[model samples]
Target: MREEPVKTKNANRLRDERRNQKDTRNGGEQTVLTEMDGIKNAISDVLEQLLNAEFKKFVWHLWNGVGADIERIPRAALENADRQDVVDRMVQKYTTNAGTVAVQVLLNINQNDLAKQLEVKLQKASSQRKGSALLITNIRFDKSSQRSGAEIDEENMEWLLGALGYSVEKHTNLSGEEINTAVSNFSKRYEHQCSDSTFVVIMSHGQRIQNKDAILGVHYDPNEHPDDIFFVEDIFSHLNSVSCPALIDKPKVILIQACRGDVCAFRDPTNGSFFINYIVDMFSTSAHKYDIMELFRKIASRMQNDPRFSQSKKLLPCIERTTLVKKFYLFPGLMK
Candidate 1:
């Protein structure tokens, strides 16, 4: 019988519920899709504008260096420009500057470019079959009665080093006299742990002598002669002996982060010379591009410019090596 349109009650309820759920899901999905498309378009436009602006700026800088008016160069010259042409011009300009041409190139290459180049060089060095090991040591002692401000945060130092890939062993509550003994014992116990491809980093405070030598991290009481200063060289010197064969022909990196004497210097507050901070920053940003020596030189330069370090009349870092070339060679070399 064609009775009242055979509407099954249960089927009608199920159909309504299914339609409502689908509509809800689709509405949410449409909102998300629209938001994502807008974001994508905005990012694409920004990137394109940035790239174009940089290219135009490069051209302008090149024109200025050559004593040519940028206005004279047609806008069409830069539109759809050849990247190779820009690079070639840069090389030519650099060479001209090198040859004592009095032209000042105004290329605004960022520090990031420098960092990338250094990373490439480091990667290349590391690839050349050099050994690779990580070393860390943290030594802390009571501040000398004479030195009221020289406090060592041994716990933080140890934690920081370990974070930087070092195996840390803590020597607690040791006196200056006990330091030497502890270091000696620790060295003997782990001498075999180091390989030719090892990397060693020592963190502590010390004095800078003649802006050439760095003394070890130790506190000397008033009236104690400067000779009482413990030099990092002493601790590292033990590793130099032929008897300790594990470290021979290896790359050792010693990082000292303490004031070298009370000779205060004016340093730039924005970029002061905190040795540990500099080390961490440099390694994190440019370690891939530069070898240890080059990286150290940059850090030293940064320290010099820092106003907070202006009082550092002659603070310098010391590197003693039997063979400078072999010792400073970074593993994996520079990357292409």
Candidate 2:
């Protein structure tokens, strides 16, 4: 992960400024705060500007459901409901890659108690703790590479991950066997073994397996001929419960930025592919306000608006498996 020395310095400076802003009359103590409060305060900027004035009300109504008045509910039950549990009850989405649900809905559900828990977690800043690592296999093929745009995408990813304090390991242009070795070895790394979560990113030229939807890598043997590419499922096979015990309860994020087929849609010689562009765009503005799936939805919405998209159908980004028990946040600290 690369950083601009100045951005880090500036962000830290701003953070310090806010901390010492002196909200109270007596300078005896700095302003008190919590993680959940911080998150809600940050997102309030977006919510305040919402065009649909009644969106929050509607989400709350939906949460209350067809019956069961809020008036009758006991305070004890409300006090006990956690944010993660509240999220599970409020939204019914694909078990795999159900992505982040609406922040508005989250704020509306048991708003007091859940926020308190999240606030505590946030202030602790556990996401940026040591031992956490991110693995990236950025394949810009040596000969038939993904173009200069891909390089920019790699830089962007590094910055984003770095900002979140991830010790990012990037492996570029690997063969099928090498890719397997890299991941197999990574799963065993001592750093990740002690970490709370992991992210695996693969970018390459890929093809769909015959009659199947699995993505295949651009692996070619020394004979100067194409060979068996990786089966995308192998990603999970290597990291799932029985296979990689270290990541059993931890969040394992897999993002594939490869071309799924031989087709090309709206790619720019300067800006790069649609996926990479929107990825940066979404993450650049996102401040832990939405989950990875919710972020993907934002990307999907933007892709739908592409000038050439309606004319030339765009490929959808695969959700793969989203067996996350709790929502994950990159929680980038300060970008360089």
Candidate 3:
């Protein structure tokens, strides 16, 4: 009798453990379902607010980005679908990423207000994240003339990086080799594991060597130390996937404020260089609402109209070596 009671107790414990495991599994699935429902509802709210013609345009734009992919919903499936049906299909096809896709499409249609609303709604569920940045400014050079008004540029950039929630690691007056070493060391920093994005802002006098962009170091001189220049391509290699796995799939924003041609940075006697001033102005005012790319576009547009960059002295800020795979918004003040 005693043996039989022991056996029965063992069997009961085993069955209870299995039941608990099953409940946990079901609970996870239920959480996913709840999240999907929330996305669908939020997306549907925007579609509901749209007029007939606008709704048609929205659908057309959505299909343009999503169609032709085997994993995406077929266009035929959405041809006659209502708002709720379209929402359901998007959620079903893209899962958690559906909200992001919807936001992109909304922005494409000039529905900025709706897109911002949707993004805010989705942001509540995102995990808290941090970022880091490297600001390397070579204001004074050995042979080349000093970067006039670069002090102001450095201050503005540092402030902007902080506002964007990045802990800035700044370096000044480093040689070509030292700059390379700084970047190499920064790439290996453990902070990257916890960071969602990073920035590498290098400001110096630059020249094109055999059609390759090269940023001159503080010790660079044409006659004395001609080789004291860091190639822009090296920066990419240091932070690329093969070298810095920690930053893989995360946004790596590299802003180079060096001239690609013979022209040097134009400085306002009081403020700073034209590039830095415009960047600080645009990002400070509109970063919370617009993504990085849009902010850059606004800056470019401003430059095009400004009296400073006349036909006589053309200074154009160019973006190069872009490897970003997704939209990056500063969302300033969120961390604060």
Candidate 4:
């Protein structure tokens, strides 16, 4: 007679048996489709894509539950909670199913794309390296030529570059030769091989010599024996396709926030220069939605409409040169 067929257990049989026993003790069946941490992270990430007002609306809808199975959380409990706090509360209330509930809230708020993003699990999309940026700012100069508020521009630019996923190589108060060397070295960096684009931002006192834009170095002085200045054209030469093969076919943005006058650039004592400030504002608000050219147009439009230009009509941030083959969007927070 054949022996009774012996039962075989899989590798996770012991663990599943223990889980079943624990569920039995709780008097309910609990199936964990996604881990608690993963649920919280996905919900938090998707919620952050919403604007401030949209975020507030999302929080309100989340609390109301509207037509969902989630429990009605109190307003006072979430009134002071931030985004992370809300994620925590959602996960705590719904356990491993918070991702689904959060997706529903996003849909209710008309953020359908974001809702879809949350519904579909995402894996790492790119293994390429993050982009790189070169920032050169000259604030102080000889003969008491302190750029009263240039530091603000440096700080703001650094933050903006960082937010766009570019590791910024910042140089402050460098001489002309030093600035050139910095750019040359930056162009050779291996990061550009994997990066999609790069930025070269130079801010300083500027003057037009022989119809060429040049930024005055920190040591430059009108009466000085030797002039210390870096021609803006040389920057293009260093990062051009011939010189920087790594950046070939990539969008290279060159921003020169300096005046063409013989004297120092216009700047606020506390706030930075108008050009840099406008750049920060426009990029911060619209970079995610619009391309670089569109953003430049918006900035120019703002400058043209400024009340300050009503009298002189002189200072305006214009795109000096652009060699972009296609549109470039920052798509902030999408990478990294």
Q: Rank the candidates by TM-score, best first.
A: 4, 3, 2, 1
What lDDT tens digits, residue by residue, belong to model 3 across residues 12-73? 11211222232233233211113344567678887899898888887787666743442546
Mind giving the per-residue lDDT tens digits that candidate 2 earns over 1-336?
111011111111122233334344343422323233344433343334333434344334444542343322233333444444433433223121111233324355434444354445444543343434444444345434444455555666665555455678887767776777777777877786767677787765555566443333344432464454676778788887777898787778787765555444334434445665566556544534566667888888777775544555654565767776666655533211
**Runs in model 4 lying further than 4 Å from the true structure:** 1-129, 262-265, 332-336
Model 4 C-alpha lDDT per residue in residues 123-156, reported as the tens digit of each score: 2112122588999988877753577667877887
Ranking by lDDT: 3, 4, 2, 1
Candidate 1 regions exceeding 4 Å error are 1-164, 190-194, 197-231, 259-273, 307-322, 327-336
TM-score of 4: 0.64
Model 2 vs. true fold: TM: 0.56
* Number of the predicted model whose lDDT against the real structure is largest: 3
Model with the higher TM-score, candidate 2 or 4: 4
TM-scores, one per candidate: 0.43, 0.56, 0.61, 0.64
Show the colliding residue pairs in model 2: 35-119, 36-119, 97-322, 99-293
Name the weakest run of 10 consecutive residues (lDDT summed) in model 4: 1-10
As a whole number from 0 to 100, the lDDT of residue 192 in candidate 4 is 89
lDDT at 190, model 4:
90
Each model's number of backbone clashes?
47, 4, 0, 0
